[model samples]
Target chain A: MSEPSGLESLYRELILDHYRRPRGKDLAPTFDAESFQVNPVCGDEVRLRVKLGAASSDELGGTDILGQVTWTGTGCSISQASTSVMCELVRGEDLGRVAELEAAFGRLMHSRGLGLESEADEDALGDAIAFEGVAKYPARVKCALLGWMALKDALAKAVAGDSSPAPGPKG
Target chain B: MTGLSPETVTSPTNAHGLCGPGGLPDLGAPREPITPQEVERIRRDFPILARKVRSGHELIYLDTAATAQRPSCVMDAMTWFANNNYAAVNRGAHLLGEESTEAFEDARARVARFFGATPSEIVFTSGTTAALNLIALSLGELAQGEPPASSAVPHICPGDRIVVTQAEHHANLVPWQRLAARTGAELAWIDAGPDGRLNLESLAALIDSRTRVLAFTHASNVTGAVTDVARLVEAARSVGALTVLDAAQSAPHLPVDFRALGVDLAAISAHKMLGPNGIGALYGRREVLEQLPPVFTGGSMVEIVTMTEATFCPPPGRFEAGTQPVTEAIGWAAALDYLSHLGMDRLAEREAKLTARLLDAVTGIPGVRLLGPADPADRLGVVALDIEGVHPHDAGQYLDDRGIAVRVGHHCAQPIHRALGVRASTRASVGLYNTEAEIDAFAEALANVRPYFGATQ
Candidate 1:
């Protein structure tokens, strides 16, 4: 038989594993901030809650520890799996580490399925490396990035203490 | 390639793009079926059809409902015009300008003749969305003041009902919704059945005397159901409401006549009809065109301009307000010419066969539900499917792997999706050139999706 195809590479066993039974699939009862994001194209949505604990001070200047990351969403396998992977990777990590992870993930998504050159960046991404395949299809990048976007927004809302309404979607 | 004689290739089309002797298909011409071999010959015209996708898989293009693939002849026409006569149309006194202007107006005349309309009645717009918005904005402007002494543009006043159908694409529905919001005209829609067909039972009560405009699709982009234009037009006419048809889907697939449909105004996108993007036509009845106010302002549309005020040009010119999509118009006319040469009735008959094959092949697959009518009659080749335990995004990717290009997501018709009780669907639409073998391959690929994804709880 022939080798794995591009679409098969996108839907790896790890991705289907997470999609079937996602971690952080439930909304946390208590959280510092919450953000609701929707992919307008497919109507996929994620309401992500980020809870920050006291600063973890090995390298902390003013960075808060991301104690918990929980979300509730309904979408395609890529979106659901990406959210699951993101929550698993970022929970209990310091804010700085989370930022680095987010940036690295962004680079991976923009890599056009070639993947990150830096081994450290790939290791940091963990299961999200399956999503490098998502970048090949430009339309699906939004689905894979949905949860990460919600994390960014919720963390910003938490930092500013701005209790604004969940920005439903960009007009 | 097999040599094709002129008689074997097509029915005779006159210089004006009308049928010469066999008579117009929309009139009384017998259905001349396009054979599979003829379809293969026609496919040779489209260079993109020969393209390989992904890992050397033959391309199976099933997204013609969104936008059609252009043939080499259309490209040749545009390239020829640009090489020989590229200039600002109807403006410069140069010879090239005159030639360009002649080509541009000739394109308009061809499009008008294609729609059984006069050249003066067709206004070129960016696309279907732009055409719809222009009509809505113009109507909204009319509602702001008294009806013009010479204009037939309907006045949509406060509390007037603007009726639409639930199966309308966002392009048709959203404009009317905005128009109603701006003018205080109450917006309403004919509800869709479970199968996404518009429920005409509600037509009588909805389109009453208080209705100003009835805007709807000639055929639904998502559902593939052709709306009964005559029924809707009759209701609108009895109530003195102007009818607006979103002919973007139907015009490309069938033999369409604006006069025969009896809709006061209609919109059609060239891209969906094997022409280039950024060009479409807004067809208005001559009387309606003569009376309607222009939506866009400035430049070519205006006749005389003072420091304070300006007088506008007639119908078509009044609507086309800037440096026109001149090259695209030429290409669109060439596309019309190509379709005219094919004999629309024959093409329609061919597509219907393809539709029947597609429907049969797809519906036979277990755990797949059709988003439109199962009956292949009245419906075009546009087919949207709801796959069990598989989101359209994932399913679309599955199909894409095999070099099948289908549209996923809500298809910009979220309301109809909601009506059909689906968030989104994977749509496979056929063009005149799509073959039965492609449909079989699509079906086989689709069957593997559920097995690959497993049963999602």
Candidate 2:
């Protein structure tokens, strides 16, 4: 195979910038909802804390998440940057729209496809699209997706009201 | 013919001096009794040591724990057999077949002498892992009483225990875990103290009447701490447990006598002991071997075959099922001969001195911590250390740049690393051919590790 230029693109300055100075980095004292996610292979961890505001049932059913999302965790640059980008995208989106974004990001990270469903809003994903380069390096894909998976877990735990304290990051 | 002195043959320095200023050692140095110098010269007979690596850098191989570089004698022995005496052993009357069979059996005899065991007790294996697996499988058979029934065999009931120690390599530990899983047996371990020594008191307490088998290492590959085999064997006997010793590390460094150690069975790999890869030996007492059933059975091991049923050969042959690593075994035998010519006692002494030098050098460095026993006498020449604030892989890479090779990470003993409260440690191990000058260079390289890594005192 030809030498991969995507690997070089994956380590680009923009991605590292997000990693070094992540936006929306916080740990809520008490969360409306939270989820814990772990990348079992390399032990990268991320937790998503969400605060959902009251909304009409029709608004909830509609695919536009308009809620506050915050994240905190320890991980490699890819994981941290991805979490930062994810926080920016999902902060003001509806819960239903957040779930759809997570599914699309998973597919993109796994290199399944570049296209999201036509009905799903793609504009909210924003800088998270930069991680598409990570698909070329299988070993680093977990680093890129660690935060999104944590957000998924935290949302589920927040809804269930059974979120235990997130575990500390360790090798 | 001019009688060449043993010293002249052994010491490269003496040989070079005798031959000329820059040629091979002098053949006419003052004839000392067959000194270690003679053994040193014999080592030069192996050509791999002379090879260049990474351009002009001479290959400074310090990875004997992983596998040893083979000598010319071993390589030639195997190549000769494969090229000339090529045939299936024990099944043909042709000359090539007979020659192959003799070479294979002769290899077994050489290995038996090396380990101070009888040929009847030695079973040729693929490697140490396979040998340990064979023991576990055979023990499992006895515990279950599957076939080729022996009423005298000890039965492992639900509450019976198999004892091991925390310092064991995973190859030694995992097999017993599987054995315990298969039978209703309980697996327990004697914890290593902070100094990386097995706690004798805890070992004594752990081995009670219920303990069926007590297995442990002859030495820790991670810590390099030599376990007190005599005391541990006594403790195992007190509890009526059959002791199995993992001599993978020890067999390469010291003289291993299975009978003298008084263990029921021991496992050793040829590759670790300056031999070719893909061959190891399992030494079991004749009585014990007879009692244990064959784990893998198909060809070669069978004695009498019928349409419906087949009987197997006794002990060593029965256990050695399928086609063996015949040429590898022969090469291993040659490697043992190489060790024998050097004398194991002297080799151990040289290694002890190297270990002391390594310990002193590493401990002298600020922010560098040597794992296991700090005292040189307490361990083998294998030195495992951690430089403060620097990951082991980084240290390994740094050393690599300096042409100093060492192993890093948990050394495949993860539980021990966890117990020691470190993610990983770097190791520098020595072999028979290693010199004091080499040790000095290694120590010098290690001294530079902290500053290179930018670790604070």
Candidate 3:
């Protein structure tokens, strides 16, 4: 028999695998900027640290590179797996391209269960596409976006050189 | 609106004589413990219990601790009021206005009687949070000697103290913290033991001569643990401190008499007690009401008005400042009538059986660690469980897919969850309409949690 329509799409084996054994889950010892994100409704949280490479002036334009994307969080399968997938997709990419990826993922989340029109966007999201069913639930959408929002906040602080010491993740 | 006939809305068999002898369910004698026949009859009174979810499964509502589903009578009462008797109260002179004001005050008298209080002592509020805020903010003003205080002020000062508990819901905890900050008074707490019961020994030590207020929940909405109210009240009374009871969780499931409970004030919510939302009650002793200055001022609450200054009205009228929840209060009175017809003692006994079954079912499942008291006699139907490896969100989703509704997370009592050594837990609470089969289904769903998360491997 086929699985239930609501459960299978959101809890695909690939998503569960990533959640069971997350990637880049350790906080980086040295980082330019760090930020903590909390889903106050459910008490899920993520403490993310990002290290940025020195800016290089390219022939096309000046671009900032992301040296590492590392995080430690306690949340459900969707949030943990989304964080793992995000770290894998953006670790070695330039900061500008990573921002574009975040925007694309955000659009998919707001799609209300309908996926992207273009295959290019779908291919860009990789395993993140498994979260398409999550958009159907208004409550779970925030879980899929926790890590990406943290990355955006952390990157902004890293560029501003406002890296003052902050308290670690709370229980 | 759905049909309101007994056969259509109520049970076909009418096993409990719901529509038979007396107009309502009889209250003279205690009913037997809940049977399947009783569940069938009670389930028919609530139309929402028959609803189906996405998977074509019947909805099992186990989140009654958050808010309960209203019976058809309560909804019908609200609809009848809106259709026949909608008017702005206390400000109009027409026939409808007089009718509306009469109905509103009559509802207040009924609610007051339900809590063993006088109509003048009960103030209608938006809900429990608003009621608690009204008390806390007014106490702060009373301490400041606002509006030229009478003899009622506690006169809190720099060296005074306010005592609460670690397990208080944020609604009760945050207000007292703000009161302490505003008055420059020290804040203290009664800690909980491993079983989630308040430590009365610590409470005795905490209540001193300088303690002005002692606030706590009559029952924990998260843990299902009932507090020792009389003991705590005695401690506060010995020191001349006022006692404020959060009855939001207890008023629905238990028989509560604010006067007999010996607390100076109590807060209750209508939605939790099977009434409409946006209406609750603040019960204060006549003397305590005199001491608490009005926090919200305007319109009907004022006794005399001037460009620069105004004097407030008496106890309840002084607190009800604006256009009140008139229709909601009428419906709440109907809810109280419904409760009384069924009998609070019988309802409590039935809930005890359901809670015992839920505890046994969940505890028998492997890897599920039940929080709060192990004895059903000690706790009510709110059961929070910690599955070893499944986060509460995941567990909640797993159960939701199976058409079981349970609350997951810290449940607005974060400090207690921290004390219990977990980020969050899944809670399955019951109301009067819950059945044994539903409890079995919930436990079966919970048993599948670890396996679904692949933790068993």
- TM-score (0 to 1) of chain B for each candidate: 0.93, 0.89, 0.93
> Which structure is stronger by DockQ: 1 or 3?
3
Arrange candidates, best DockQ first. Answer: 3, 1, 2
For residues B1-457, write the lDDT of model 2, one tens digit per residue: 1222222211222222221101222234333344467546745865676766532556666777777766666666566667767678777778777766776776787788778898999999988888899999888877776444443235677788999999989899999999999988999998888878888888757888998888999999989999999988898888667889999999988878899999988999999987888889899988888888899989999999989988989979998888878778777876776666556766777778777877777788878877799987888877788777665654665565556678876777877776777757888898766766777887777777665434554
How well does model 3 score by local distance difference test? Answer: 0.85
Q: CAPRI band of model 3?
A: medium
**lDDT of model 1 at residue B150?**
46
| Local distance difference test, candidate 2 | 0.74
Clashing pairs in 3: B152-B291
Off by over 4 Å in 3: A1-3, A54-62, A166-171, B1-34, B146-153
Report clash pairs, candidate 1.
B151-B291, B152-B291
Compared with the true structure, what per-residue lDDT tens digits does model 1 show for residues B118-214? 8998999999999999989888877888765544557877878999999999999888889999999899989989887889999989988898899
Q: State residue B405's C-alpha deviation in candidate 2, in Å.
A: 1.7
In model 2, which runs have C-alpha deviations exceeding 4 angstroms?
A: A1-171, B1-43, B51-56, B146-153, B306-308
TM-score-sorted candidate list, best first:
3, 1, 2
Model 2 CA lDDT for position B410: 75
